[model samples]
Target: MDKKYSNKGLKIIAAEIQGSSKQAIGKIIEENNVGFTVTKGAQGPVSIAGIPHAVAFGADGKLIFKGHPASEEFKDVVREALRDVKVVKENLGGLVALGDVIEQRTWTNSEGVKMVAAVTKIDVDKVVFRLQKNGKIVPYPISKLSEEDQKLIKGMIEDE
Candidate 1:
């Protein structure tokens, strides 16, 4: 275990299950010169799949293994967890979402007052859109918009 995961910033715990001896674990740690925080035995034995059970946790707090630590599956899982740890150390931020979707709808309200807006949302009784003049959600009632615009808005409501 020391040779495989030395200097790899992994919080490994060789826990004792079923009230096992600590000498064996201690001997192994001493021989390997393993730099671990806690090599002590648990207060009470944990009964999972019997005594010796190894569990690996990734940097993202996800489980990697819960069985024998010396198995092939454990090695593969540890490698993957190491990769995740490395990636997390290098923080990732999302890229810009520029002009993904924009719609220019010409809306005319009551008293023949016309206005051009970027339609953001169309609801059952109102159209919530960004006014072209100033970027703000303008809640224009469906009853106030022009007849043709009302038909389109009603279609949107029916589609939902």
Candidate 2:
């Protein structure tokens, strides 16, 4: 017998509000016909999956929205809710492509550390890489680097 598998894309929408609490954001989400799950975690310079982009509302409202990062509609809804708030900053990452199973390969980094990463998706010539470094699927910008660097990185991944 033979079996087949399919690939499904994961889409997430997230938000970060400056002056409101998670509970407050929940209420707003409910009112806006959107759903969200909030947890206590660190909001930092790095893009953490499931964490929303922070937006500040008034002097006491801070909220964040997390969903499909590639969904423009989801982003629009979050933007509308935050229409009255001041946007401090927008930190978001794009989609990545984890190549086919047959071509999936693992490579080592500069420190002689073994790493597994896959090409999840590509955006505007930027290749999104899923680095299995910290047990999390983190994305890195491969298109911004120099041509030589890009080739080097691609070679490293393709090396058996």
Relative to the unseen true structure, what is the C-alpha lDDT of residue 51 in candidate 1, on a scale of 0 to 100? 47
Estimate, for each residue in 1-91, the C-alpha lDDT of model 1 and write its tens digit.
5445543455565554444357776776689786664455554333357445777766556665678767899888888766533211111
Worst 10 residues of 2 by lDDT: 1-10
> Which predicted model would earn the best TM-score?
1
Q: Which 10 successive residues of model 1 have the least lDDT summed?
A: 88-97
> Model 2, stretches more than 4 Å misplaced?
1-8, 35-97, 100-160
How many angstroms is residue 14 displaced in model 2 relative to the true structure, after the best TM-score fit? 1.3
Residue-wise lDDT of candidate 2 within 1-160, one digit each (tens)?
Answer: 0011111212223445355787787787688765334443446554545434433222233434444545775556545553553322112122223342212246444344455766554444445556556545445565555565467556545642
lDDT for each of the candidates? 0.60, 0.44
TM-score of each: 0.39, 0.24
lDDT value for candidate 1?
Answer: 0.60
Give the Å shift of residue 158 in candidate 1: 54
